[model samples]
Target: MTVISTGVYPIDKLLNGGIEKDIITSFYGPAASGKTNIAIISSYNISRTGKKVIYIDTEGGFSFERLKQISKEDFDNVMKNILIYKPVSFLEQRKSIFLAYDYIKNNSNSIGLLVIDSISMLYRLEKGDEDVNEVNTELARQLQVFSEINRKYNIPVIVTNQVYSLLDQRDKIGIVGGDLIKYWSKCLIELKVYENGVREAILKRHRYLPEGLSIKFKIINDGIIEYKE
Candidate 1:
């Protein structure tokens, strides 16, 4: 598939027919803004097609309950196609990414998507003790591997990032990796909680699409839908 639906109609349309193949798409946001939810739905969307989805979970964000809610009848089959890895530390995270690459390289035709939900969780934790520059460089190296996989195997990579309050800019929030993440991600979307518990996805950067395009949606139990109210 050239592109895979996020399983949310408005989001799919906003993304010009869903997340594109052979590129890295990033969804960054504050807590409870649907980043992980989108990741889960996207994995299911691809796995349902009989393709393998390599999901590297750094924040313990993968929920069996939620996957069951989304997959429903095909839960067993879809679950089998999704290979999930939960890395406890930054080093473990790097190892997991390498393992994912190896699996994809060996089973190139079967892999559909690679997701690192909250990719920066362990990075953030280690930043304080380790040299900031080294941490950033390691992050860059990890992303470079993903980029190579995209070009080599032609599978989509989706990663989630946490936000931090910008220093001296209280009202603003910036993604964890900032420019590095933006530079690597071919498509970038910012998720934000909007009025009455709805969420908005703002297209920050894309190769063809104009920036600042957005859509509003709500996260329901089964999946997400365009908000009507």
Candidate 2:
């Protein structure tokens, strides 16, 4: 299958050519670890190739200023092809995601990327009020929808997730969506802040990449770049 370039050289090299198409890839990290940056840049890169992108933003982190910084002259055109949906609540998010999936399945020839920036934000917020069984059921349904779309249309699905520290395992962290997210995702990447502005991406789980492998990168004005020693 074909791969979509993330527009970051080191990342592309790490993945052996960039993100693989028709799979669910997730990025999990604490705040300010540059998860959103990678998603935006990858979406922008895919849009640059004359294909459309469906971006579902749950945290209101989609920054036009940042996109302009990365794309410069192509920003306006790129934005045109990127269909963005900002869903405020869990119900709204689910609706938006399914709607996008339906649209893409019908217009499969035009779309190349599907992104959900922080997929678990609204789910986490609503979990307190809802029953545990209901939450898990909803999450499972959502993942099933994503998987179906990916397999049918051959479109890459990239999602960002929040992380919580594991109290017993001090060095380990768990993603918000728990095992369902872990099971559905074919590629799982974890990001950490190394310094003031530098961040590192750890390939925690991938079909090919060994666990514990890491690459250092920084979020610059033009998006993510490989960090230099």
104 Cα displacement, candidate 1 (Å): 0.7
Writing each residue's lDDT as its tens digit, candidate 2 over 65-178 gives 999999999988999999999999999999998899889868999998899998999999989889978988998899888888888888889989999989999788899988
**Residue 31 of model 2, lDDT score:** 98
lDDT of 1 by residue, 3-46 (tens): 77767787798988998888899999999999999999999988
Q: In candidate 2, where is summed lDDT lowest over 10 consecutive residues? A: 7-16
- My TM-score estimates for the predictions, one after another, are 0.97, 0.97
lDDT measured at residue 29 in model 2 versus the true structure, 0 to 100 = 94
After superposing candidate 1 on the true structure, give the runs of residues whose Cα lies further than 4 Å from its correct spot. none
Residue 166 lDDT in model 2?
Answer: 95
Q: What is the RMSD of candidate 2? A: 1.1
> What lDDT would each prediction earn against the true structure?
0.92, 0.88
lDDT of 2: 0.88
